[model samples]
Target: MKNIFTIVLLFATLSFYGQDKKISFLDLVGNNIQVPRGCEAQSVYELQACNGTSIKWDYYSTDMLNEVFNATISAFAEGNSSKTEVTFTSFGGQLKGYKFKMGTTFQYFLMGTIKDQPLMINLGTPKDITKSDDLDGFLSLFFDEVG
Candidate 1:
C-alpha cells in the first residue's frame, strides 16, 4: 500500500509539470497594438519577468519593398526595402541574433560581438534601420504605420 501511494503521488507531480504553457505578446503591450504576423512581440518587462528556462523572440517583416526603397536616400545603402526576416534566440541564459534577407536582395547577416552575441534584428533602410540595434524597438516605433 505504501509503494502504490508513492507511485501515484509521483505520477501526479509529473503530470502537473507537463502541462502546456502559453505566453502571448499582446499581454505585454499597454496599448492596443496589432502584432505583425511572423513577428514575435514581447515587452522588455515581460521578458525580465519570465521564469521559464527557455525564452525567445522572433521577428519578420514582408511586403515592404517600397518602404525600403523610399526610406533609403543614401548611396552606401546595403539592404533592400523588400522582405525582412529576423530571429532572436534566448536560451540557457544567453541571447543570439540572426537576420535573413529575402525578395530582390538575398543575404544573411549576424549581429553582436564575435565572442558574446546579443539580440539580432533586421536592418531595414539606410536611414532608419542603420541606427537601431533592437528590432523590437524599431517595430514599436513603426507600429502605427505598419500595424
Candidate 2:
C-alpha cells in the first residue's frame, strides 16, 4: 500500500511539473493564427519609413509572464516609402528590413519598428509550432510576428 501511494505521489508531482512547463512554437500555429486562450493581440500606430545611408533599431519587451507576452517595433518616418534594414539582437542574431513597401501596412508586416527601423517580419509561421500550449506559444508567435 505504501509503495502504491508513493508511486501515485510521484506521478502527481511529475504531472504538475509538466503542466508548469511552457508550450512550444509549433503548438501556436498548428491551427492558424488563432489567438490562444488567456492571450491577446494589440496593434500599433503607423510605421515610419526611411531611406538613408544608415538607420537604427531598438528592442523592448512589452510583456513577460506565464499569462501573456508582447513586444512592439517603432521607427521614425522619413517619407511615404523607405528602404531600410533592421538587425535583431535578441534570440541569437537576425537582420531584416523592408524595401519599397508602403508604410500603411508596415505595422503588420514587421514585428514593429526598432530604433526607427522595421524588424524582419515573421509573416505568421512557426518552425515547430504546436497546439494546446499556453502563453509561451503565444509569445513565440508574437516574437515571430505570426499575426
Candidate 3:
C-alpha cells in the first residue's frame, strides 16, 4: 500500500510538470499581455493570443485618440448591426471599448494610452461572448495592460 501511494504521488508530480505552462508575455511594443501555452508572438503588430485566437496591436499619437476611436466605431458599424461598446474590469484595469461580430467570429477592441502613446489592442475569438462577465474573462485571458 505504501509503495503504491508513493508511485501515484510521483506520477502526479511528473504530470504536473510535464504540462505546458501558460505564460504572461510582454509585447515588443511594451504591452504586458497574456498568451496561452502554445502561442508565440511574431511581431509587435500581429500575434496569436492562443491556438485559435488572433491578436493585433497598433500604436498612435495620443492626439489621435478621438479620431481613431470615432473611425473605429464607424468602421465597425458599417454593415454590422451588432457593434456595441463593451466595458469591464479585468486583471489589468477597467477596459472600455467596442465589440462586433464579423462573420461568425467576434472581435474586441480596447483603446488606451501608455506613456502618452495611443495603444489599440484587438482580440479575435470564435467564442460568442456577449455578456459583461464573458467579456471580462476574454480580456483577462489575452490583455493585461500596456505597461
List model 3 lDDT by residue over 1-147, tens digit each.
Answer: 999999999999999999975445646255566554566765545667564677776777766866887798788788888877776443444557888888878888877654445667677888765554453443455544422
- Model 3: which residue pairs collide? none
lDDT rank, highest first?
Answer: 3, 1, 2
lDDT of 2 by residue, 24-78 (tens): 2122212224334543233221111212111122233432211121222224335
Candidate order by TM-score, decreasing, is 3, 1, 2
Deviation (Å) of 4 in candidate 1: 1.5
In model 1, where is the ten-residue run with the lowest total lDDT?
48-57
Please identify model 1 stretches exceeding 4 Å from their true place: 25-101, 104-142
The parts of candidate 2 lying over 4 Å away from their true place are: 18-96, 99-119, 124-147
User: What root-mean-square deviation over C-alphas does model 2 reach?
Assistant: 16.1
CA shift of 131, model 3, Å: 5.5
lDDT head-to-head 2 vs 3, winner = 3
Q: Candidate 1: what lDDT?
A: 0.33
Error in Å for residue 84 of model 3: 1.8
lDDT of 1 by residue, 1-147 (tens): 999999999999999998855334442223233434444435532232122111222222323423332343222235545434333222222222232334333232323221232223233332223223533432433222210
* Cα lDDT listed for each candidate: 0.33, 0.33, 0.66
Candidate 1 vs 3: which has more lDDT: 3
